[model samples]
Target chain A: MTKREPFFWITVSCGIIVLAFILLPLIEMLSAPSAVMLKETLKDKDVVRSIWLSMYTALAAACISFVFGTPLAYVLARTNFHGKRLVESIIDLPIVIPHPVVGIAILSVAGKNHWLGQIMSELGVRIMGSVTGIITVLTFVGIPFYINAAKDGFEGISPRLENVARSLGAPMFSTFFRITFPLAWRSMLVGLIMCCARAISEFGAVVIVAYHPMIAPVMIYERFESYGLKYSQPVAVWLVLVCLSLFLILRILALPKKNRNHD
Target chain B: MIELHNINVRLGQFRLKNIDLNIDSNDFFVLMGPTGAGKTVLLEAIAGLVPLEYGRITIAGRDVTGTAPEKRGVSIMYQDYALFPHLTISQNISFGVRYHAKAKSESGSRFERLVRELNIGHLLKRYPETLSGGELQRAALARALMVEPQVILLDEPLSALDPGFREEIRLLLKNLHESSGMTFFMVTHDFAETLSLATTAAVMNNGIIEQAGNVQEIFQKPCSTFVADFVGMKNILPAIFNKHTSRIGSLTVEMATIPVDTGGFIAIRPEDIVISTHKPASSMCNSFYGVVSAIIDQGFSYEVHVQVEDITFKSLITKGSLIDLGIREGLVVHLSFKATAIHCF
Candidate 1:
């Protein structure tokens, strides 16, 4: 028997090109900044405040998605209704639409002169240039990632598990809490991480909606535009390192115990 | 007792119409049907998982048509076991204790007893994905039994078991029923399982119950061609019957004992037919001589297919008989069966 070859090297070359495309820039950004410069950027009050603001606001947005998106995902996974595909596509709209357009879309509904904005303003709640506005924009752009991931998680579970739980003297809510929720937690957590990552990195929507309470992305852009590349590089590196550490920690927490294997 | 009166369920393209079933208390009722026959749908309706568009369900003489599954005191064990993969065996078995507080008070000892009963004590700390198929089944059964449900619905309980493990589980299930006296409503397509385990059996076809009666009666006398064919009766010969006699395969069978005027099919079980080399002067209503077309070895018994004219009759004989008669292909043999053994439908 003859061994076939050549196509293996071709495939390996293509894979290497793709890997380099993703890794090269991240490596350079992490290494290019001097240690003193990175430390100085972390010490800057405005830079420190913006990073804290970015983390808390993104975390808030992720929590909101976790609360509301899980039920929508469960419905999509378990039930059949007319226009379900249409609903899924609409949920997915933010991912494909331009980020600035997403900001504009939120603006039209929640802007100062809009009907919802008028009601909120009458109640002394501001939508423009507020923390609520930042979180809103973050959630608007980051929801699709959360919902899609959580839906995949719910879909991977067998409906029989829920049915069996129901038959075993558990009510619908009880079964969901005891059976469905725990089984799908891993996927939901991953989705939450992605949503937070997307929210933290948001620039165009956050810039348009609430630039006064600047997030990390907008601050980086402002530093680059007003000062120069050197001013923004360290802040960018700081944001990246913080997000990378948080992502790793959350992922580790979500991992199953070492003794038990996943299904 | 559980009764489903004129139940109608429409799920996508498969519709179940006018399905009426009566399961007495403590009766091991098995619903036997081919795939896509809505057996699972019927069981789900009884358990209140699937809604019924028409008719009502009465359990223990109470109208529970609108009751939830948990409120109905019913539980279901699925074919895949459906044990929670994240929970250990002990937690999974004790899951329903919170709802039934009366059972909860005694759950400490009951939990130990159940794990001992199901032979899953050593697996208490392990996750569901780590257990084998039989272990999963036992855990699922333990979970269902822990709730102390009145009616237990099983969807092919033994279907997921290996051939060697199936008999053991069957014995275990039989013992559980004898001790617990829980009304079991099970659905299976395997006839052997139905015969060995069921006290009563219902044959469903195209979402309709063709026959439901005692298991032995249903096996011996199926009322329809569909039931007869599904119950492992191979000789279903189409025939024309007058008031006195019905002619099948160039032979006349006396119809005075059975009341049927129109033409229908005669279903004879293979095991009921007696095979011999020569014409024995026994009091059998029908006899025929045919050439042996094929002798199929069925482990415990041999299925001898004989060609009598254009009609082929299959007779089941013991391996000992196959050896004693020296039955082989192309040999002329006499086949005889009593008039009572033939079922006309």
Candidate 2:
């Protein structure tokens, strides 16, 4: 593409500023943390436990997003009901609202004083300071990624394709599972990776809800406050490497195929 | 056989009200209409995609108003083909086959046989995203027919294909309908499809069937001025059949040497209205002495507009004749056509 005008220069400048402010810190972080220190810290009992909690909670949160959010995403993608934009705006709230605010909101709905939490408590379930609280907070913050991705996936499929399938002898629900979902599965996969990454790195809401069964993020923060940057660097390095590798893999997977079947 | 009785479908902006039509088994029915005439809606209604607001749709003598699309035993192909992009051509065709049978073994074996018969046996492994428009359509047909649907509905299936590929698909569709004996209902805005493939044609306007008949019958003998004009009738006027003679209707019928049957307003095709710059001899059919109102060249033919009394009609003539006659506006000419050429409804 040819350089257009001053607008092009302005866009480039803005891009430069964003990368410098956000990515430079990550670059510096990689250079400062040695592989030796990270390897050594991997053996730490608390470090290992926090890593385990992060993986499990992220997995649980991703599963929850898939189960509950997918149908809602599909509905939002396919239909044009009243207040659809409003519903979409509401789904996007978690991504924009401060993570701490997300914690407060989740607490009002599912905390000790909430009806949902009390009902679960009656069934011998606990939320505050428990693994459930950690996963719930992670899920709450990470849901937007899954919903948005799945919605785009479903939207990419023409409704006519589903119509043709239905006309050919597939029922309503069967058409979705057999045709619509599979075509958009690659998009859903990218969404899954994003949801998992978001869940693992979730700090504000998870910190507020259940800092006890410390996921890696909370552990990093505690170590930074109590023992300073040196103790937390190893965990941060490990998290970054894991997230980046998965992101690359998902990017490759999401690209649609290209080949011609000549008649 | 399929029939629609007073079928009413109300979509967002387009509505099909009081539509009634019938098609026999092994018929190639073409729904020809202008844009937004609810042709697609009517096709979808038959395929059981869009719900019927009122009236009933009967397929093969069975009431299918309440039945779901799959159970209705209809297969529809859209203009875009709507092949599952994630699945290969063979897989896409086999999809519906496998889908209906709970056992994988039964569907797989049937799909194999279908691909072979459709002559797309080689494309069973190529995904829809990778197929050309023609390939996708063949695969889509294979898939739809694999389940042995009672009727096939095509939604402008030729519109998306490149010009070179359209004829092949048309021939393929024709042969398939012939050999398979499947009732084929197709919607197309293109007039050529109606000419080439339609055994029966319906001209839809403002969500109503303005006219319908066998393709040749409708084209040669249009029922209304709408059908006449749409079917390339360029000279339609509100002229009375001449009552001065032993005539059928009004003054528009003219002093026929041989009396025509019933007539209200006569619509003569531009091509049928012969134009001669000089007074022609008596060997002609219906001759009208007129003055050339305007002469416009249309590259291939001259669009010669002639006026007689209050009536004005267009006559198409070759440019070679144009040079010979030196035809121009306001020049007197003779227009003639056979009485049998006049179609009255």
Candidate 3:
């Protein structure tokens, strides 16, 4: 074995401490519940519905962010304009704002006093105590992650490649689809997984906006508040398991490809 | 054919100022300059890749200043090749075919011919990162040719290749230019590339074209001091001309003909000056006695620097001549050259 220095040992010790800090609570919660308790939790109709609702809403939020954020991300990556920094800061505001504030901000825009809320009422679209409110809050908080990731992806590509493509008679639109999109899609996928993960783990905003259709986290909180640790731990364990799977998928997708294959 | 009139481009602090150039159809035109001279910027402007502050660019009789790069019927190849990383070599070469109806119709035969000619048939399925530098260069060239563009702009195409690969691609570029009848506008700092491949050339400096003309004319008769220095004229001195005689430093050098201007710079190619141990009775107009200052070994030849009065002249002599004359540092030597060898601008 190679000789290890004091600095190396110190770094390894710090890394182990960090890993333990993150993984200890998760491992204890997952192992606390017995197989019978997990099976019983799975059989409960409310728990199952909450878990499914969380996954569906989070996935919907991710899809909506991808559709709307991609063009904005590309523009940010490729061009410099007046107040671009301001626009970028605005995009990131959701991440900095408290989750409850995000919920209140959405309600303020969608409630009856505001013009947009009046229009929503006229359209018979409700943003309170509904799945729409949950998705809206999730998207508001999750889009910044998607846009930042996709912008970094686009920035990594050389504008020279696009120029060469255009010089070869491919127009700008065709060049984007043919050249830019293929190179950047992996990063966008990673961003989508990250957005989904963030949306699924959300509790404060979803609880404030839509407590009636309880997502998994809200169910865990409600169970913890009403029953105790024994009732809430199983649902928390299931949510952690789902988030862990998404994290693993993101890691696998983010690995540097071996010989251009996603292996 | 390509014509650029009053082409002015400002990119941040750098600018290409008031440029006028005319390139003939079927011409291998090379732009030579130092780094940061805006040669690449000018090439990009011609391809419509950069926005020109003020200019009119015409390609094959069509004014295309406002046209997009695709509509201008031009293709550009970068030094790095810039092949799409996600694409196979074949896919990269044929990527532009789908956008042009005529090119799409003729792509099959054109693709085969380009692959065969470029000797990249085995590399069709390989990605750009997997290929060697020369391989990427051939694929990029093939892609540029596949579109059948009216003009092809190459930005220092051979600069990134090894010497052996440079020669190989240089020959390929010359052959492609001859066979395709397409206007090939290339930018390079290598005089060897310009001499071997260019039918006409221009020298640029600090974002302006210093001189543009026949390749031989530009080399022999540079219009400015910057062009002369950039083209390897090692001996440049300010001179005061009076009829047939010009005073350079403290030495009065004779000229075959009188110059029109009173004072200007004179440049002499190093290879033209002959070094001798003893002053000989010769008809050459200029001869000066000086001590050898330094002898630099230039692989193929020795550059003997001789100081006469306040001027130092560099002469390129073969090893055999060095041995024959017993030339070394601190040796007193006589340098002689005909007055016609000096180029005044």
Q: Best by DockQ, which number?
A: 3
Per-residue lDDT of B261-332 in model 2, one digit per residue for the tens?
434546677887777766666565467688888888787988888888767778888998888988888888
DockQ, model 1, C-alpha based: 0.61
- Scoring only the A-chain of each prediction against the true A-chain gives TM-scores of 0.94, 0.89, 0.94
Docking class of 2: medium
State how far residue A98 of model 3 sits from its true place (Å).
2.0
Model 1 regions lying over 4 Å from their true place: A1-4, A261-263
Worst 10 residues of 3 chain A by lDDT: A254-263
Candidate 3 lDDT for residue B33: 95
Shares of reference contacts reproduced by the candidates, in order, are 0.80, 0.86, 0.82
Instruction: Give residue B119's error in model 2 in angstroms.
Output: 4.8
Which stretches in model 2 have alpha-carbon errors above 4 Å? A1-14, A257-263, B99-125, B129-131, B162-164, B241-264, B283-286, B289-302, B307-311, B328-330
Residue pairs with backbone atoms closer than 3 Å in model 1 (clashes): none
Lowest summed-lDDT stretch of 10 residues in model 2 chain B? B244-253
DockQ of 2: 0.51
Alpha carbon RMSD to native, model 3: 1.9
Is 2 or 3 the stronger prediction by DockQ?
3
- Which DockQ value does candidate 3 get? 0.65
